[model samples]
Target: MSRYPLRSTLFFLCPLFSGLLACFIWAATLPPAAAQERGGGQTPSLGFAPRPKESAPDKELRFLRDSTAAAAISADELLEDRERKRVIGRGFADLRFLGKRVQADHIEVQTETRDAVATGNIIFQAGNDRIVGSRIDFNLDSERLVIYDAKGYLGATYYITGNVVRRISVDRYEVIDGTFTTCEGDKPDWAFHSRKSTFQIEGYAHLQAPLLSLRGVPAAALPYAIFPIKSKRETGFLIPTIGYANRNGLEFSPRFFWAINKWSDATFGVDYYEKRGSRYLGEYRYILSKDTAGQFNTTYFKDKLEKTTLWDIKSSHISSLPGGWGFSAVTDFASRKNDDRSLERNLNDRVRQDTDTRLELTPNLKGIPGSLRVAMRRREGLRENDGDLFQKFPHITLDVSQSQIGSSEFRYSLGSSATSFYRVQNKKTTVLQRFDAAPSVSLPVQTVPWLGVTANFGLRYTYWTDQKRTPDVPGNPSRDDQKQSPLSREIWFSSLGVAGPRFSRVYNGGFGPFRDFKHILSFQTTYSYAPAMDSRDRKLIIPIDNVDAFNDQNTVSYGIVNRVLTKLKTGEGFETRQLFTASLTQSADIAEARREQNLSANPRRPFGDVVLDIQSRPISLIRFTHEAIYDPYEHEIDEQTTGLLLEGGRNWYLGLDRTWRRKRSRGRDPQSGRSDLNFSAGYGLTRRWFLEYLTRINNVQNITLQQS
Candidate 1:
């Protein structure tokens, strides 16, 4: 058995010998290039790898291949030397396989661990972000880049630092013993520093620290914090606002946001006041589609016996209708809670029953394509005083018209409307109930020259029901039903204006004895007349109706005189233009002759007002106004007002205003003739410093000052 085992062992040894001989022959026959290709070195492989030598141009990037000071070197975008390779560059040098760069004065590369060790002004740009350090060790095989004594920018938004940094990904990193700052790059605030942080390159970060400094001065330390740097819909706790008020005392409001979706969101918050207890509020808004959107807000509070709250909700929708029509609707509602304190003690009197409603719809309307409109509105208020308590009956209106009605004559037509009033708080007052329908037809003759005349006719009917107090007799003129009965009437009228373009010219710059400056001015005039109306006198008038006696006339003489407009351009970004228009106006009153004789009063002077417009480029504003009222008959100024504004500069502004009035002999206050001056000023000295002042001085030296 021993001999047999020995024979097996010998057979195995013979093959092993033959294999060794074959290897020796192969190695002896190989070329020198082949040996070198196999990473063979002239010297025996040592535990320490040799360092690469520095390249020329002294300022270029070079690599250290070993711990020794001198070694062979390779200068390339990529270096692949087994002994070792390091970059010595003034700016930057990258080790490709290691997936790292060294921006340092000196760097040492090692093959055992396959890492580049850096020193002196070292920076590593890995992926999108970068890091700076006094020293660094980067591992190519592990794709791990680490730094010590580091500071640099994080994705361009925040300045970051850590005693050690281990980048997990292009967008993710782990920072130990770190600091965060708003200063970019290597700049330091010196006031703000962190102990530890985990940051995300995608606009968020988680921080953990015992204390954080502001401007390098310690403010407060937080155990943990989560911040979002991206501006978008994000859910988080918001900064709290705090203030002191006489009624609420020291109050703090903290809000929270909920990121719902791209089209909708919500916000909720709470108020903690020292004297007023706590209050909660919520607001929600969203867009349903391209043409539909709405918002709602509500607030609630608590008390012992009686709690008061208010909720407001509003919604609107715009929809495309069949044909070329469009539809729009808006709705709003408010509800209030009332209890003992609110009603009896008047602590919260404004919470009493108050409701307002409005609804409208249109089909094939004018101006708007394809519109017809039907709308109703009502409002009610409950109050303790008879004069304060009031109610509005549902006022209904229906109107239909076309945008471009006729070719030769663009005619617009309107249907009548109906409304009624039925309630009054005072028992001595009678309820007013009435229905009115007024239909009007307007035909405007037009041509390419923008000159034409128009004719209009309107018919109106009113049904009225009058009530009387049950107190006195008719002869004595006490409230009686005999004189207050129902009345019905129909009124008709036709109006015509032979309107054609009336053009006039004017010359400006006649002021300050400077006739040298000239300007062109234009004017237009319109003369209209209306035939006598059949319904001149009436037993009753429509409630909630705008009295149009101001716009009526037998012959209205209106001419736009001296339409003066100014034009100028300046490089200082301040351009001002003023347009002044004057017109003679009057009301058409067929019964004016009788009213003047019977009333025994001054005949109303043709009521007229001059229009003025001013546009300024510096402040980017347009103003339409009328300030000076001249009594043409008396040849004196009745009322005057002046207003001006200036807007420019980063933290500066200015404005001015003045007003004056004349008192009449019959009805005038003792101090009515005095002029009033009101002015306000504000300025921002710096980004964080602001100042504001307001003053109102009457003729009696009643001066008011406000500041911020």
Candidate 2:
């Protein structure tokens, strides 16, 4: 045996094919533990097809019966009573009726009533189902039976045993001193034993005085329990949870689910903490139609320790409407301010201090796809004293998709937006309204299989109804600048990108079961030029967001992409996969070089930081990735991330990840730097033994922020 790895590569375009094929259905007798589709379907377990009238599980499970045949019976010794319409058999008697069979040592049957009584070594068989008992009473026509000391096997994977068991109806059974197991071996790995129990074949079960056992040995006992018998979603109470936390003391919660209907469901639960009172949690999900589905989750509680109320609500919705329209929305809101941590919530959510709610609608404008979006956001802990920073009360955008220009290679796209930026502090308010539009046209051409070239030209126009002096600038603005109204600005931009000249080589070592290996090297280049804005015009711009901090870019970027591909041997054939990939890119600023040349400065400004990305999956069970950004001027790796994942065997899995960012100067914000290490691993010592561990270490920024 040898290790083989599976791989995936991202491709911009690929060919797809679809064809219609003639097909037929076939019946198979699956293994004892095989799964099936129950509820009104054929069992197919007893090496036979199903009868027509047995359409619902609520009806009898019957095999195919001969239409023009008579009842058959045989025994070593037999007796008949014509007057009473009775028959008696002794010494291993056997009877066969319509889709039913029975065998016993002594048997008596009534012809008119279709009833039978068997006492010695009785065995009854139905559609893919069999039962053994000492004494049995059955109705042939109704397919109902009762037995004493019954041990039964039903469906594909279930077993039942009881002192007294009755098949009240189809899929419903009553038992006393019964046991149920789905395990496959002669001795079940686990089972549920109960004194009084009722089982529904495709639904759930209710057990009284239930005892759980592992490998036939009792492990735990519960006063009452309910278990879902099928794999599909079912309306029932979920398993209750219990645990202890340092601040919450003891915690307990039990959840109930309502199937509502085929397309919707809801789950509700109440969490009780010994020292922190109670919390209510709920979630609702629905699918109104093929194109519509949504979910909402919420949690609320009144804290006893803080004597305050807390809540968190979230929702996500996506639906397509008539008239070539599609809609989606998401919302997140919280009440009060705290860590938002409880026994029921993850501690990592404590870092959240801001939320964004957005609504969007996509339209097919004369068969062209476009989208309109409205969003609002709120932020906290942005100021030194930890007050309010800024809010986008309602930002709007409409963007049109890029499309071909009427049988030509040229393509065009349009984007427009409106936004209101507001800041609140000390009962004073600062507000600004900004509007902008940007449209671009692009041409893409591929002259050869290995070369692609694209050129783009765009114009951006912005208008502002409000303006405010930025405090960070060197000098105060004149009165005339402050009084300026309805300011607007415009700019034209262009860019070019070339991706081509892929170099590749194939090595034919013909290693064991492998055909060969292929390696590819490709280059990508992009250049953009934006004219610098004069100081007079720059002063008119409002100081908000990245758009306000725009800088002239006369820069060119170069990137090299490397990829390795290999074929793996499978039972049937060989399959190709990507074994490794790495990309490196760096940029040179021509504008900075020209500025330094006029100043006649020595040792001109160096190129921008270098970025490196690498991914390797040498074997099926191991993966590694590394990413880093290095500053050439500072001669240091300013940011880096490395991760490794492994699965040694069935029970030996592990992962490690490290991320760090460096702040080069002391004046930089302390919170801008981070060094975090995360590790998680779990292993099974044996079938009955296991070990697991996980941890995270944050080595920077000791600030404590609050949220609710």
Worst 10 residues of 1 by lDDT: 1-10
Task: Give one clash count per candidate, in the order shown.
Answer: 29, 1
Per-residue error for 266 in candidate 1, Å, reads 2.6
Instruction: Give the CA lDDT, 0 to 100, for residue 171 in model 2.
Output: 68
lDDT of 2 by residue, 640-670 (tens): 9999999876457899998999875688864
Clash pairs detected, candidate 2: 338-707
TM-score of each: 0.52, 0.66
Tell me the tens digit of each residue's lDDT in model 1 across 1-708. 000000001112122221111100000111122111222221211222323444221212223443332223222233345444433322233233323344554555665555567676666665445667788776544555678887666655456678988777656777888776543223322223457777776556776653545234564545555544332456655444445544446767777777688888887888776765676778777877775666666656664223445344555556655654555555545444332222121324345454455555555544543234455554444333313224434555555453346574556555545555544333423355566566667776665343566677777666666523232322112223423566565656566654445454445543431232223333344444443433423312322345223133454444333444443444654233444444433333334533555344576544454433332232233233346666555666767777776654535566677788877666666336757776766664322223455455675446442211
Error of 1 at 389 (Å): 6.9
In lDDT terms, how accurate is model 1? 0.49
> Which candidate leads in lDDT?
2
Error of 1 at 107 (Å): 30
Model 2, global lDDT: 0.68
